[model samples]
Target: MMTRSRLMLAATFLLLSAPLAAAQDGEPEVDCENAQVQIEMNICADRDYQAADGELNAAYKAAMAAAREMDEQAGEMGEHYVGAADALKRAQRAWIGYRDGQCELAGFEARGGSMEPMLVSGCLADLTRKRTAELKAVSAISGN
Candidate 1:
């Protein structure tokens, strides 16, 4: 027979361990840049970046839907899988906003230049590539 004190200690240990285990299995960090690029870079890169973002968003949605379906069928195992999928989706959305804002800022330097479009597009491309890596990392981790 276990003592009351031992039972209480065991319960506390389980509680603490649950969160620690969950944390250990948590999502990986997504990296983005804050470097300054020339105006021509911004103008030239924006559109391609935006297009890539759109593609990522679509893929994210598809993955999310699949996760939801798995969750529904999983009965009990669904929670963890679905939760990770949701997290990845949310991260992708945040990245999109970050990409747009960064490209916009990059265009500021070329406000009156003939090369503004080229600069902005270039900025977009650079940021998009970074964002793509982030999305790919998450997808890999999530096994999506």
Candidate 2:
């Protein structure tokens, strides 16, 4: 009976720490689809946001490159275009600030709860995907 009790305690401790461990390790221990606990769910949410952020970064880079190309073309034609890349850099910085604030507000519904991180991450993913689409459009327009 003592051994059984000890095993139960061990299981409880593992269960409680699983989410924290996964969060710190930056990888979920199980498949996202199979995530049933709060930590697993949060981990999955974070992963989704990370994927979206990756796409956004790629799109932003393409857009920046395209803008620089445009500036070069204008320069070769004896035309002056100032702050082409600078403007894009500034816009991206502002957008990041807006996205963070928006997600923080969205998470207010679950404030101080276990689900707040998931809520914030989901919001961030949604906004980031939208931003990626916008950057892709910019890249296309800039002839990248």
Candidate 3:
């Protein structure tokens, strides 16, 4: 029989490793059935998707920084730091979901074509740019 400490450690290790094991399985492949539509789809779709991903990453970092600043300011003001941190985290999560969904919807027109990737990428980029602008506005308001 294992000791309690050993059992706890094993549980922790399994929990940490679960995601890594799942990721190694890889995602499903996209199907491009129409050769004739591939070129247009690729150009129109992937560019947006790529752009959205880039924007999302940039905005995420900016939001994280802003959140940290807010927490520090709140601390200095003798306010609840946890509340500020939680708000920031919630905003970040919402932003990520919004960005992904917006990009995916933008690429819906080319979903089954070679252009699907391009459309999705382009959509993501455009949405990301928009999101970054919003984040900048928040920063301006926060004076951070």
Candidate 4:
């Protein structure tokens, strides 16, 4: 039983590490600015995208809060006015779809290859940053 348990543990380790071994087969240090391998580049790009996405989420939340404030003001006017919050929610949903489709197209050149993820992630990061700026601009314009 002891020998069998050790054998199973060894097998499990190999199975779990196969992909990691293949990924870092000959790769060097994974530095974002000086990434030397495809995997490192992809990892850096994914990190950038994730960071951008987080910022975008924060901006969206702030924008949504501002929109709701506008809606509140309109409601206080006791008139049938358009809802800023509703419009913002609809536009944000549409923007997310557009960003995803556009980034997918951007990665078409490297489709099904190791570079596809990097390209897609880079595009996502760029668009997300731009969208965050746009949301901030809208909030500023709305005096919020």
Tens digits of per-residue lDDT, candidate 2, 1-144, equal 569889999999999898678768875476898888887788899999999999998999999998788777778777566457778899999999999999999999999999999999999999999999988988997777
Selected candidate, larger TM-score, 2 vs 3: 2
Ranking of all predicted structures according to lDDT, beginning with the best and ending with the worst: 2, 4, 3, 1
Go through the candidates in order and give each one's C-alpha lDDT.
0.62, 0.89, 0.67, 0.88
Q: How well is each residue in 39-100 modelled by candidate 1, as lDDT tens digits?
A: 32343244456676677666566556655555665647645544655665677678768877
Between 1 and 4, whose lDDT is larger?
Answer: 4
- Provide the lowest-lDDT 10-residue window in model 4: 22-31
Give lDDT tens digits, candidate 3, residues 7-41.
99999999878756764785222334532455445
Q: Report the Cα lDDT for residue 121, model 3.
A: 73
Range of the 10 consecutive residues with the lowest summed lDDT in candidate 2: 76-85
Ranking by TM-score: 2, 4, 3, 1
Q: What is the TM-score of each candidate against the true structure?
A: 0.49, 0.83, 0.54, 0.78
Structure candidate 2, residue pairs in collision = none
Best by TM-score: 2
Q: What's the lDDT for candidate 4?
A: 0.88
**Off by more than 4 A, model 1:** 1-82, 142-144
Q: What residue runs in model 4 are displaced by over 4 Å at the alpha carbon?
A: 1-29
